[model samples]
Target: MQRQFFRYNAKSFPKCYRELATSSSIFLIFTAAIAGCTNSSLATKQQPATTQLFSPQTHLASQPPRCQTAQLSVSKVSTNAGAGNVAVIYAFTNKGSSPCNLYGYPGFALLDSKDRPLKGVKVIRSQGTYFSKQQSPRQVTLAPNGQASFEIAYNQVRDVGQSCPTSEKIQITPPNAYHHFTLPEQINPCTGQVRVTSVQPGIIQ
Candidate 1:
């Protein structure tokens, strides 16, 4: 029953909502990631400009601190729907004076009118969606008043005798941040599944 409204590497962005164990498997994955980064660096000499532009670690010392929820704000910019699926694009504008960075996927939770989490809903991060083809998560630098965006997409199918659960608001926690804020938007996803893309530069269509 899987269709391609959104796509992601399960290896890179697993079920992020759950807690991970501090085990050898985690250590091995980290080791592999570092190896991959090192290998990419070897090719950097061949593509100096490309490497400098996309590689966040090239000037890691100069990169701004991670964007905290206190330094930014989110808005539901626009939405697209078709072929029984819908995608919503949201932007996080840097409201603080200092520049900051955002990388990877934001955490999301749908809450009912009473502020309890909606049951039976699943949310996972994706690398791309039907509306946009984007790269894997990279550091998105946000200068003062600048923005980075991501998309939340889901299927909207209903069965014959039951109605989808109603959500009265949306909760968003920026990547690597512990706290969250809520948006007063209603949602009703019948399939109980949702996909979110990693944060990227500017507003993505």
Candidate 2:
């Protein structure tokens, strides 16, 4: 009777074993999906921290002086007949070891024998390749031990037989971003007794 009972259970065991095997496979697939999502979240959290470490910093220095010295010499002068303009040429050399940036329009004031400011003296307006844009005035960047020339036009004539002393001063303004230097007043020595003659046109040669 016991052997007959064992044989009856063994014949139905195949169906029960199939149900157990299917359930085990579904459980394993669900566990793998959960693990993949967990790893993806970890990677996203670390990305921002890595980017912050390599970001650049923002900092700036101040501007330097425009011209190193107060001394400037007049290299050439001429008159324009059509426009009634006087073209003045100036040569500047870097006496120091550093470079400089020139700014502002050149102005001239005629002086009498006593160095008094003479009115109505025209410093002709220059309309040439050298005229700087109103927004960004003429700026010459001189290298270490470098030299540059500046041309300016004025409306004033060199009055004939009139003994007048002429001098020029350059004004430098700092850049908009930073302020490192001051635009101090620089005065050139008087070129004594410049006699005005007939207005002519041509190069200073």
Best by lDDT: 1
Error of 2 at 195 (Å): 16
lDDT of 1 by residue, 1-205 (tens): 8876766545665555323544567888999999999999888856545443577676886769999999999999999998888899999999999999998999999999889999989887789876778669999999999999999988887879978877899999999999888999877888898889999999895
Q: For every candidate structure, what is the RMSD over all alpha carbons to the true structure, in angstroms?
A: 33.9, 11.4
Which ranges of candidate 2 are over 4 A from the true structure?
1-29, 36-46, 49-65, 69-88, 112-116, 128-138, 152-205
* lDDT computed for candidate 1: 0.87
Q: After superposition, which runs of candidate 1 have C-alpha atoms over 4 Å from their true positions?
A: 1-60
For model 1, the run of ten residues with the poorest summed lDDT: 13-22
Task: Judge candidate 2 at residue 122 and give its lDDT.
Answer: 42
Write model 2 residue lDDT over 71-172, tens digit each, in one string.
Answer: 222233332323433444444455566666555444434544444554434433333422222222445565665555445443333356654334433322
Q: Report, for every candidate in turn, its global Cα lDDT versus the true structure.
A: 0.87, 0.42
Q: What is residue 76's positional error in candidate 2, in angstroms? A: 6.4
Best by TM-score: 1
